[model samples]
Target: MKNQSNMPLYQLFVHPKDLRELKKDIWDDDPVPAVMKVNQKRLDIDIAYRGSHIRDFKKKSYHISFYQPKTFRGAREIHLNAEYKDPSMMRNKLSLDFFSELGTLSPKAEFVFLKVNGKNEGVYLELESVDEFYLAKRKLADGAVFYAVDDDANFSLMSDLERETKTSLEHGYEKKTGTEEDDFYLQDMIFKINTVPKAQFKSEVTKHMDIDKYLRWLAGIVFTSNYDGFVHNYALYRNSETGLFEVIPWDYDATWGRDIHGERMAADYVRIQGFNTLTARILDEPDFRRSYKHLLEETLQSLFTIEYMKPKIMAMYEQIRPFVLMDPYKKNDIERFDREPDVICEYIIKRADYLKSELDLLS
Candidate 1:
């Protein structure tokens, strides 16, 4: 019913069309140039399809990056998420806010409407992209190497796996910064994690990793029940100045009582201890286990409670409701959208209770 008439000029690709496709089999087109608009002002940006399963769906998510101005609002790139699975469209925003409130390095998010070449693509979440620009904004050193983990990044020692050829360091990780050395920075640490004596794992690992931040990050994942985040949907980086690895949150649309494919998970989806190889082994350490318990208890008492979270959810609902009702590409209708906040509200109440019980059993 709408026409996307004019395309902007940043449609150039240094690489050939076939080579630049997101995957060899799919998406052979170059990034389309579009003027990203909010209200009436325009942002000069190039847009491309983002994500695996979501890309295949009719309601698509996108990656927005700059060409000329090269940076917009202090970000080199941005993400325009369909928020397709989330009926309430508050899961990722809520998760990020929860992490930020705890003083973690979380991405800044805003809800915006995307008018592609003046055609309404519907209301979407505009998120600050993770890059050198993001690290710089937080005053992190320029040389900090950023790597993204996804479903394939099992955190297992790739060296131990039986493969025909040598694997690239960039296999599971999507590298962001251009490190001068092509050597795999994280492989040794990963190998040591699985091979080291259980007694020494905690101490040895903490030397190269920010164990405290990792634990808090784990606590956030468990508290939110972000089932997919344990393996993927996270960014890992070794601070250039500090040389210690840190975890960064990503893709929370699958969180808050849901799975990657938009299926409803049990409210207590991720309560168990052995979620991932790396973090689970650390949690087995007595001191770390105790710290995790304290963190969860503190969260349940202060951050994760329904009384504290409900109002935030309600606030987000208020802002997005009008756009949701008007969104032509939204997966669900306004009535269904209206129904989710109440359901998510109840899920939060139940989830907090379930996590408390799980923590007690562990203690």
Candidate 2:
């Protein structure tokens, strides 16, 4: 809140109308000429489609969108989406910074400054125009695909459990009668992080690089305290050139010590890495599990080694901590967690430590 208004220019995007008004309002003063242009024609009809590039418009313009557009003219404009105007928007923008710093960035993307309404807001990002890069038109051959599962098809596993728990209490239903069903749902909800070593599914890089790099990415998410790894948040696509599938992560809410499940806050990395018979078997042989375990350990060690996470974690806490207040009704639900910021912090630290210890053993 201190310097929220002093946001940088690159972080901001101006609607064509807004751009024209700003030019007129501050005519005598300096205004950054519109580097990026919006396709007002496209944005007018569909709320989902933010804008496409109009040939008449300038190059290097950007747009914000909540959903993917159906089409773009000539791969048109670069889009920096703040689809959800929530507490995590700034973090998503900063994530571009994080990826850039780590030197693992894929697309050309980063946060920039912007002034919107009377107040200055943070979390604006800039991306390279999609047209700049080659958009692969040739689809890859279909095969067995490994995906991070989203919600349960019938009902979200979490919702089903809650409903069942409530129903059992009202009636005289025995716990054991539904225990098996409950466990099945729990097992079903866990994500599949890595693929098995089959003749067809094996990657050439798997033989070269130690699995540490992939695990480190997962560890970064945990170190950030993010647990929202639903399917849409990530996709591993086959790079047309190399023919290798790489992990792409998305969705960063419910992170940095925020818990959606009230009392149910588990470390993100552990939730994914924790092995059951089902997960272990799905991953094929013991070697795959062992590799994953070692990767998990190395990831933990790397995250905690230099305290690379300290400043960013604390900064995020400072930024969003004030707004994490519970609603009046929900306050009673989390009374014990009130003022217990240390619990969240400690959970994150300990999880990191546990992974480090696991890695140490592997070494």
C-alpha lDDT of all candidate models, in order: 0.71, 0.37
lDDT of 1: 0.71
lDDT for 142 (candidate 2): 28
Task: Please give, for residues 196-253, the per-residue lDDT of candidate 2 as tens digits.
Answer: 3345333433432223344444444545455544322333333334433343344443
Clashes of 1: 0
1-363 per-residue lDDT for model 1 (tens digits) = 122222111121323442245444345335656565443345666767787777776667778788657776688888878888777788898898888876567888877765543445676777787778888898886654555555445566552244423265445677777464523557666667768899888888887778878888888788777877777778876776777788888878877776776667797667647376787688788888888788778888998888898889888888777666657876357888888888787778878878867886557
After superposition, the stretches of candidate 2 with alpha carbons farther than 4 Å from their true spots are 1-7, 10-109, 117-225, 260-264, 268-284, 312-347, 354-363
| Residue 39 in candidate 1, Cα distance off native in Å | 6.7
lDDT of 1 at 92: 90
